[model samples]
Target: MRKLVIAISMLAFTGAAASADPIADRQALMKERGKLVGTLSKVVKGEQAFDAAAVLDALKGLEANAEKFDTEALFPVGSEQGRDTTAAPKIWEDKAGFNAAEDKFLADVKAAVAAPPADVDALKGPFGTIAKDCGACHQTYRIKKG
Candidate 1:
């Protein structure tokens, strides 16, 4: 009975938390996304001090943000109404592939961020590889809303 009560309380709490605040949520996500891209760009261009520790930290943040983008709450059903959302409908259809892409993106970014080039000046190869995964997913899943 105690366990059941705890579970019920947890579920209620989670349900309350799941209520969407679309604007704030999107803003927060976009902020993190921009930070991730900015950090990656700096490392790639040798503009920032390429500390492996710092890179790993940024990568972890990026991965967590990426995972959050996978949640249904963010892309709620029937949310395709005039919100500038770039998510294509095919994402739901190709759920497995979309999920796999997200997973691969996280893993690739993690590895690349964790094992960044010792010689920061010549980071073209590693950075380009990581960027490729991002582009690949965008090409398939993200809509070009021009």
Candidate 2:
């Protein structure tokens, strides 16, 4: 029993010390973005009350993630192979275009943060634009999982 406990502790420590893979990092970032966007959507659709502080926090999270998307190092070559990544090959094939798309997303998120919507009705336009941009990128750069 003592030997088994020691082995389990070693395993847990190793797992904790392991470095994160880039694809995994990106996937986690995207998941965070999705959660933030989902929360904002609820606010925009009248399902939740429009709180300026919450809206700002969500938008700021999106903006920070958008900027991270611009980092060339984040999408290192061959990073997509081992993981269950949704990233498309074209992201590396046409790196410039991918970067451009990321730049546009960053700009859009920054703009939204700068001039946040006052109410649910007012949020519709800007939120729609952000959603459109996300869809465009996903359509072009993300592969649908089976």
Candidate 3:
């Protein structure tokens, strides 16, 4: 019963926290992706010992965010102007291209998740590919923060 109460409370808190602030919500989502990538990067760079479970979890998170990137609500109109968003105005200007970039990212993430690496060495290629996808999207759609 205690566990159930805690779980319910956490859910309620999360729901309230998410709110209607699309910029904040999307920023939070991107931060989560960054953290997952950082975790995998540590393993890849030999800063951390290879952990298959952790690698798989991070891949799953990346895949989930890739899917979320497609959701229209995640980038509501006018969301780019306010908040500390790195999203560039070009995203709204070139909506089709922005969505195409997201689609490519989703496909790359799906491929990585589908064949999770068994070791850090094995992860290097797919991880690099996903990183490239992120860079490509960021180059076109995201503004650099000063």
Candidate 4:
């Protein structure tokens, strides 16, 4: 019983500590976001023939990713300093502006999901919009590591 208690406690502690690392969490979130975009980009570029269902699936995944991106929890103060984070100091300096950018990301993703594209041509505009949104945010809020 004592051993079981100790193991459980250790697991709980480690889980909490891991989850509390906002920098790592945010990085993972951003990576997932990028991957979803890549998937959609392939369809947009005609690298993959567009299947309406698959396109919708990727867009839905994007919506889910955006929903999970909580700036407050993911970008906590001081989280930009470690784990090779690229977050710009302006994120903290202009919290409102940063949040507005995040909000726009989520809202645009949701719009894409709500009105999914029916063809590659249709996907192009939404994909372009998403790419632009990402680039704009990176330009304003991310420091290029390279």
lDDT of each: 0.63, 0.75, 0.77, 0.78
- The model with the greatest lDDT is 4
| Model 3 regions lying over 4 Å from their true place | 1-17
Q: Could you tell me which 10 consecutive residues in candidate 2 have the lowest summed lDDT?
A: 1-10
Compare candidates 1 and 3 on TM-score and give the better one.
3
Q: Is candidate 2 or candidate 4 better by lDDT?
A: 4
Off by over 4 Å in 4: 1-18
Candidate 2, position 36, lDDT: 74
Predictions ranked by TM-score, top down? 4, 3, 2, 1
Model 4 lDDT tens row, 24-99: 6777667767877898888877788998877787777667667767788888887878768899999999999988
With a 3 Å backbone cut-off (N, CA, C), the pairs that clash in candidate 3 are: none
What would the per-residue lDDT of candidate 1 be over residues 23-128, giving only the tens digit for each residue?
3464456555666667868977768877765655555656556656644665555664446677778776787887788788777766765665565554556567
Worst 10 residues of 1 by lDDT: 1-10
Candidate 1 deviant stretches above 4 angstroms: 1-19, 22-27, 113-117, 121-126
For each candidate, how many residue pairs have backbone atoms clashing (under 3 Å)?
A: 0, 0, 0, 0
* Candidate 1 global lDDT: 0.63
Instruction: Count backbone overlaps in model 2.
Output: 0
